[model samples]
Target: MATAPEDGMKHPRTTNERLIDATLDAWQFGGGATISVRSLCASTNIQVSSLYHHFGSLEQLLVSAQEHAIDAAEAWCTRQIGLLADDAMPPAALGALLAGLIDDWCHDERRLAFAWRECHLNAVKQATFIPLAGRWTKLWSGFWAELCERLGIAGHAITTARFFAGESGFHLVPWNRQIDRAALGETCTGWSAWLCGQVSPPSPWRDRARALAGAGLVLPPLRDDVAERIAATAGAIVERSGVAGLTYRAVAVDAGLTLGVVSHKFRTGADLLAAAFDALYRRAATRTADELADLPAMQPEAVSHELAEMVVGEFAGSLGLDELLLACARNPALRPFGGHLRYLRGRTSGHYLAALLGPAKPTHHIDAAIFSSFLIGVTGVYCFVQDREERIAGAEAEIARVIAALTGG
Candidate 1:
């Protein structure tokens, strides 16, 4: 029931203007994966012909909408940064400024909605959205960098900025879940303090000495069998609470092992996460291979439907893959494993493409790549949407459409 902004009482909006507005509104609320020509027409009260006339394809429209959203976010951030510069307070004021900025962002529905959409799309559609995503990153990073510089904080300004922005976004999620506003503000303030080096860094040697003292206490060796059990436990933690929840302590409790045991085996949380993802990727690859082997031979036209069925089956079998991938996307330490996972998915797409298109060509390779990327985006949609059946149906329909378009069927 969203509507386009009115120019004035004197002038009615044009069909193209309405279409653009509706597209942005839909994307802001439901995300890019959910926006369609039909939905745009329905929201804008325009005909299909007009929609096509303004935007030739859904991809083109999505690009336009995303671009518009990015521009708006940039403008807003710029304005906020300008205000911060003019205010010009002491170093201690940084926390208040950040808390205020978060408050402003939380109150602005349009901006909040756009941010949520961008975050979701950035998680799953990185390849297709690289340009826009890069711009958005640069915008926030630049703002944070300037803020840090003004506050006399040194060392890796852009990196610190990006980290602060990411943490702020995380805080926003809990706030939206109806958590107390003061608690969220306090959390953001603490993060801001840490980023500005106001908080003392942990003493590594002290921890190491403590660990050495504990070493005298008899503990079981981290054997291969215990390591595998720890990895399995980490995977289950990821499945239930995502990568952020896969701490060493959590894994120890879940695996029914001592913290020292999990720590001795894994060394770091990233190590534990890497093991979990490796086990998960291997299982998914094996399952997908088995599914493909079982698929009956079919003509090229029917191949698309079969592929759709396979996609749905994969999601049905792996419920937490989407959430884990989102976590991987956000964490830099997990990128290498994430790349491997993507490669496995691409191989599955290539296998399907080979069956449908016969001999592979450069065009077939490109088609397969696009198909793989689209499936990843579909998984992102699956992460947020409530009704699994409806999301699966939509994903199937989208896969069929992509296949038909690729094959000229």
Candidate 2:
């Protein structure tokens, strides 16, 4: 019988709670999807029997960790919203607070940012997590909507909030050394101005991003037939379960090939990851080329409709590019692929501007990056909302705002 601690002292977590905490720690900081029951038990110094007795199964423990992570995320967001809701907070102070909030999520060791992202991915993979993820989306979107209304940016409140959400997602890419505190602070300050209806807010980071974009990484394309099949299968696993779920055996089974076949081609797990990432990059590149050629000639409404559909796919987790790129953050061997993708996504995103802002507008990689963030944000809003018309309308609204903000229309 353990007693609760006295005031100011930390209460000792129960055995069940400790196991759950360890699962979350692994998810947040380790290869969560691949973590074995034996590893978990060893880390917790708890017997394997205790784990089964406490949670019944490892899958159950993972679900419990997801729930715990969501609860903690909501609590933190509520506290931040409370602070931001102060009517008397000055613009400078508000900007600082907003920047601080972004920094708190992205720059620190809290790993809440990563946890939140994993939750989004898990929501896509696990049907059961949808309702919980939907609840979170509703709560946060509503909070941002209310804040936007209060700040007088109510017209595109939900989409605007989604942009911030997307921006945070961008920062979570571990290889993005460009997203420092100063950059986030300035970005938040610009956002503060935009919230107040000031178009063309100070964006010093744009020039820096553009300059950095010129520094590109080289990734060789995958050309072998057998290797391509293995890589594609592994990439599917990555999208479905995440990089943690990618194993040679899993890929071999899924690809209808033997383990030795996969091992002979890729040599190691890292080799498999590299090939898969290369395939994803090449696939994205081909799609980008097609979009550039087609999107510019299409009617704005048609383009909007097409993009809205993509957002729908994004919500379903069909787009595994994000998972692939973010995995590089943890794997040094795969950093080149991730770095190349940063440039590729920026270039790919330009098609949106070419379609909407016109090819003559002279957009840069930074503009495309900005557009990507807003679009990613819009995808989140579109995910939980079921009405197709409403989703399209939301997409259009965000597009219009992006055009106006970028063009200063």
Candidate 3:
């Protein structure tokens, strides 16, 4: 790992330190994705009153945790940059420095999973997501500008740099507890170095997919017509419902197509979502293959974290059928319907990680009992907010504790 950046100095641990640290994990794992308050309480090991005293209402706490985590992350990255003397900042040094900084976040499962769920309040006009992520985007962009200038290729730097970061990003909301960060980091480092060398300026997206051509994509390979309609439906749901309003009926109506078509093409809504989501996810996953394919025997650990972010983002965006998918299970009259939506979400998620590690068989299913409880709990906390930002911080700290207990993490 490279030397720590001066800005990386952690803030003085607070009275709410546990929640503060967990806030980073929640945002990374959940990303403005909703969960429950009971779940949050269980996760944090704090009573509702105690939480309220320190962070105010649930909503305010979410906002606070988010500010804390992002501020810390920003400081960490700045510290990494500060470590290098002006003359000593070589291209390789820059890469190594960034890698080390990223490693600090990526290798630590707790830190890597926060922003994904906490900031979800920013979704749609309804919104979710860390209010502070704009800072992350801006900071990362700045770093990209610097990196690209050092490499003498600022033209495509933003996309290139985002893609580079994407390689290690997870993008999922309320992250899968399945990933092993240490293993994932190894993959990113080895791949990051190889990718930097291969592409003149380095592109970490489809370019990498073209070379190795592993599984290419992960869906069942639908007919063009069916695929188009499916995509149209799925995209519409995301645009319309934030993440929970998607339904088979909604898909049929939006496509101006019949239920028969949806049913015939998709054995069940879950099946349809699984296939479409997987296809989309695979395209994204192709990044590892594209960006790091040339690396002799890629490592999964390095990019696993980034893939997790991508997965979270894709999942957050997909709103197939409420009954089909289960970001974390809950009871609905149409439970299968929710699973269908989530299947699509989860399958797509797998694609991002597939390039580094062959897509693992689905092992991320959550309990309907706890899942439902968590959603209600988190959403309830979020809904009561006077300040959306405040709600988000509370949500992160609260959910982190739940996840910690659930995963025994």
Best candidate per TM-score, number? 2
Which order, best to worst by TM-score?
2, 1, 3
The CA-based lDDT of model 3 is what?
Answer: 0.43
lDDT of 1 by residue, 202-272 (tens): 33332332244234222223359889898778776766665657788898889999999989887866677
Clashes of 3: 115
Q: What lDDT does candidate 2 reach at residue 358?
A: 67
Strongest candidate by lDDT: 2
- In terms of lDDT, model 1 sits at 0.55
Candidates' RMSD to native: 19.7, 4.4, 16.1
Question: Model 2 clash pairs?
Answer: 162-377
- Could you tell which candidate, 1 or 3, scores higher by TM-score? 1
Cα lDDT of all candidates, in order? 0.55, 0.65, 0.43
For model 2, residues 1-409, the per-residue Cα lDDT tens digits are 5555667587767878888778766756664564678988998899999999988988788778767777777777777677665564444354566567666776663566666666666665566667766766776687676666665556545655676787676555545565445555665565555445442255566445434543644343555888889877877787766787888989999999999998998876667877766665555444556556888888876776676665553343335666865576556666556545444465656676667766555555545655676677777556656677787777776776655654556
Using Cα atoms with residue i matched to residue i, what is each candidate's TM-score against the true structure? Answer: 0.46, 0.78, 0.44
**True-vs-predicted CA distance for residue 408, candidate 3, Å:** 53
